[model samples]
Target: MQFIDFKKEHFSHNKEAGHYFIQISKDEVGYGDLEVLEKQDDDTYSKARYELVDDVSKVTIKMKNPGNIRVSF
Candidate 1:
């Protein structure tokens, strides 16, 4: 799973660093969507969408089934 960590400094940082916005305005950023990968019986993954929770300082993803799940943004 790959995560964009907003916990770091903006604009200049590593891959996990946040600042994912392409353009920034005074009070808004860009619109983005997330992709989820669900683990299958063969240990492979399949594209799936469940629920994504975005808080002020934290982000969460909920899956229908409780198992190994990976998300990309």
Candidate 2:
């Protein structure tokens, strides 16, 4: 529930700012996961496997369940 709360806050604040996509990358497997709190339009957001592009800092994620995401940047 805390994660959901955080996700909601992130979406509410960022959606207004036009941040439609959020990517999360980790160095190790099972570091963390993302979950959807709300949905706007037809976008789907959910926890997904990130494709490692470069280092741990760079990653590519597909928004399967469109919603807001909350992760430490």
Candidate 3:
């Protein structure tokens, strides 16, 4: 499970926009969830910050079953 965001003008809206992807087999549980927390154990990472520097127009999710999936941005 991961969120990929390309902060560039040339990447276009599709790739540039944040995308949360999770790959699972059909026979498996087929469930996933994503949450981007501001603080990581009372500390924040350099790349992942609470402040929003760039505006994300769209967020796409790719999964086999999205019924149990939740995304927090």
Candidate 4:
């Protein structure tokens, strides 16, 4: 599922002119590959899979069937 919230200031609109926030979350128990993409000038995307960091944070805990994770962008 996808959720998009935005505000527009004109009758004729441009998507780039709005301020918005997006939230994407899986609604079921799942494990999948996550890919990061870079947008190109001609409206195409380049996919990139980054290496997962092992020790970015000092805090560590064990989670079983975890339902929530926080990511800051």
Candidate 5:
């Protein structure tokens, strides 16, 4: 039995410029992992960077399936 199941996990950040999103695997959500969803070259870049920080806050875990986990920062 599993507690969660998802076909894909997504991460995103919203800024004055636009919204950036990325699909991440469960294995990548760990300490010292540098996950880059998008990069912008403008004044909004800093804001976007800030928004991206701590994006994985709500994470769901599932049994049996290695990829059936969700992480929100």
Candidate 6:
């Protein structure tokens, strides 16, 4: 839910800016395996393995039947 909220607030801005990365993980802390979602020049989404830096925030995630996965700013 926190991630959804973050998306509602920030995703649009990032989309408009045209250069942003969305860090995806199996936990809020993002310490384990992770992925990065990015918008390409064709305005499509792409994902890849990535390791986030220390600045990302952690919050409880609530979603329907998820694998405890989360997306963060």
* Runs of candidate 4 exceeding 4 Å displacement: 1-23, 28-30, 48-73
- lDDT per residue (tens digit) for residues 1-73 in model 3: 5433322221222245343333323223223433423223434422232112221333333422212222243
Which candidate do you rate higher for TM-score, 1 or 6?
1
lDDT of each: 0.44, 0.37, 0.30, 0.28, 0.31, 0.36
The digit string of per-residue lDDT tens for model 1 on 20-70 reads 221123123223655656667897778755555565544455443344555
Better of 3 and 6 by lDDT: 6
- Note the residue pairs that clash in candidate 5: 54-73, 55-72, 55-73, 56-72, 56-73, 57-72, 57-73
Instruction: Give the Å error, residue 22, model 4.
Output: 5.6
- TM-scores for the candidates: 0.47, 0.24, 0.22, 0.27, 0.22, 0.26
Give stretches of model 6 more than 4 Å off.
Answer: 1-35, 53-73
Q: Write the per-residue lDDT of candidate 5 for residues 1-73, one digit (tens) a residue.
A: 1122233243334355354444434454543333222223431211113122334542222222122222333
* Reference-based lDDT, residue 13, model 5: 41
For candidate 4, report its TM-score.
0.27
- By the lDDT metric, which is better: model 2 or model 5? 2
Candidate 2 local lDDT, 4-32, one digit each (tens): 22343332223553433444445422344
